[model samples]
Target: MAKARILIVDDSPTEMYKLTAMLEKSGYEVLKAHDGAGGVALARQEKPDAVLMDIVMPGLNGFQATRQLSKDQETAGIPVIIVTTKDQETDKVWGTRQGARDYLTKPVDEDTLLKTLALVLRG
Candidate 1:
């Protein structure tokens, strides 16, 4: 079977690299974008199985991108997980409202990330 493809949309180079490495090690095909607009474009073009997004990007923020992706018929079925530094309850609620399937704080746990990815993919 083919491995799942995941797009990592984050402005932080370190975060992007870490996630890519981890996902690759765990047998997931990783795609990357440094900003939200690029992320959305990639989501449309690549149609990745899932998206791990960051909220504090330079333009079009993750929440906005997620809303667009979730609402657009072409990308609506792809699950989005907000992987961000925002840890407040309000932030999580806002992400969910924006159509994120799940949320993960910065310094994402390897186990949790894998588990969340599996859960969303299965759903």
Candidate 2:
């Protein structure tokens, strides 16, 4: 079977690079977008296996993007995993409500990220 394709939506170049490197090393095909609108567009066009969303951004934000993806019939089947710096309980709850399969605080642990990805892919 082919490796999963993952879409990473983050405005920060550093965070994007880190996540891209990690996912690539773990054998996932990584697609990237700099902001929420771009991410939503890419996700709709590519229909990637999963999405790694970052919360804070200029316009649209991760929460709004995730909600859009989840609600859209074209991308609703794709799972979203929010990878943000926000470590609040409410954030986690809200992310799930927005249709995230899981939430992880950044800087993310490689092991946890891989494990979570694997589980999400399986389910």
Off by more than 4 A, model 2: none
> Relative to the unseen true structure, what is the C-alpha lDDT of residue 110 in candidate 2, on a scale of 0 to 100?
96
Which tens-of-lDDT digit does each residue in 1-123 have in candidate 1?
999999999999999999998899999999999999999999999999999999999979999999999999999999999999999999999999999999999999999999999999998
Model 1 residue runs over 4 Å out of place are none
Q: TM-score for all predictions?
A: 0.99, 0.98
Q: lDDT per residue, candidate 2, 18-53, as tens digits? A: 999999998999999999999999999999999999
For every model shown, the clashing-pair count is: 0, 0
Total residue pair clashes for candidate 2: 0
User: Judged by lDDT against the true structure, how good is candidate 2?
Assistant: 0.96
Which whole-number lDDT from 0 to 100 does residue 81 have in model 1? 99
TM-score top scorer: 1
- Each model's C-alpha lDDT? 0.96, 0.96
